[model samples]
Target: MAVQWHYPLMSNYPLESDTNNIAAYLYFFKVLHSRKEKVPDILDINDITTFTFFKSKSITHNHMSKWGLSDGMTAQLRENVPKYVQQINKS
Candidate 1:
């Protein structure tokens, strides 16, 4: 017997405009879970609530470093997640 590992196929440019796709969405969740951070159940969350949650939860340099982000990229994400979440909701 052989065991097969199944994983979602992620896009080459995960943050591209095609993020409206389910695969991109799943990739987001996968990254979140990989962090092992405590996240609320966001399946039913509205944009406002999601924005509020992200606003309340700051992403530290340590967290970003753990995710292998460069200092500049970490800073970008720290500044962008909340703002980008709004744009994402609109799409």
Candidate 2:
């Protein structure tokens, strides 16, 4: 899925580290689940619990405006099982 990391209400912007970026991604999902809003059916309990940060890319302010970043975002979904640090390199 095309997860939009450049979301507003993001407590931190230009995420300083990979760890922080990953945390932000996970946090986004947490907020989505908490809101109990209309979410893609693909996001089942197991998917939500197992969702992992696959990748992210920077976006421009103009793009953010066009898409209504503050309102929330919808993107392609990538699913993966949680893995240990050592196994991360392999996957």
Candidate 3:
């Protein structure tokens, strides 16, 4: 699947960390479903106890937009799963 990161959102957005992740993943599925994108029907979550799923550069951005998270929070999702980090990596 071709996951695009540069979504329409990310401008002065505001959201909590956990909420962002859930909403982002939800959004990811939404987009994929909308476009009829083919993906493995079975989603192998990292751990059943935790709602966290595997992170990927390809799926990150589009997913992040689903939640009302700010760009700052989105930046944090890269290295830190908390959703908000003080600084973003320039890399």
Give the top-scoring candidate (TM-score): 1
Could you tell me the TM-score of candidate 3? 0.26
Worst 10 residues of 3 by lDDT: 41-50
Backbone collision tally, model 3: 2
For candidate 2, lDDT tens digit of each residue in 1-91?
3334333443232334343244334543454453443232222321332234323234333343343333334332222223333344553
TM-scores of all models? 0.34, 0.22, 0.26
**Candidate 1 deviant stretches above 4 angstroms:** 1-59
lDDT per residue for candidate 3 within 10-81, as digits (tens), equals 211222343334434433334224323212111212121212443554456556544443454445434454
Worst 10 residues of 1 by lDDT: 38-47
For candidate 1, write residues 22-59 as lDDT tens digits: 33343444433433321222211212222232334554
- Each candidate: RMSD: 10.5, 13.3, 13.4
Ranked by TM-score, the better of candidates 2 and 3 is 3
Candidate order, TM-score descending: 1, 3, 2
Residue 56 lDDT (model 2): 23
Question: What overall lDDT, based on C-alpha atoms, would model 3 receive against the true structure?
Answer: 0.34
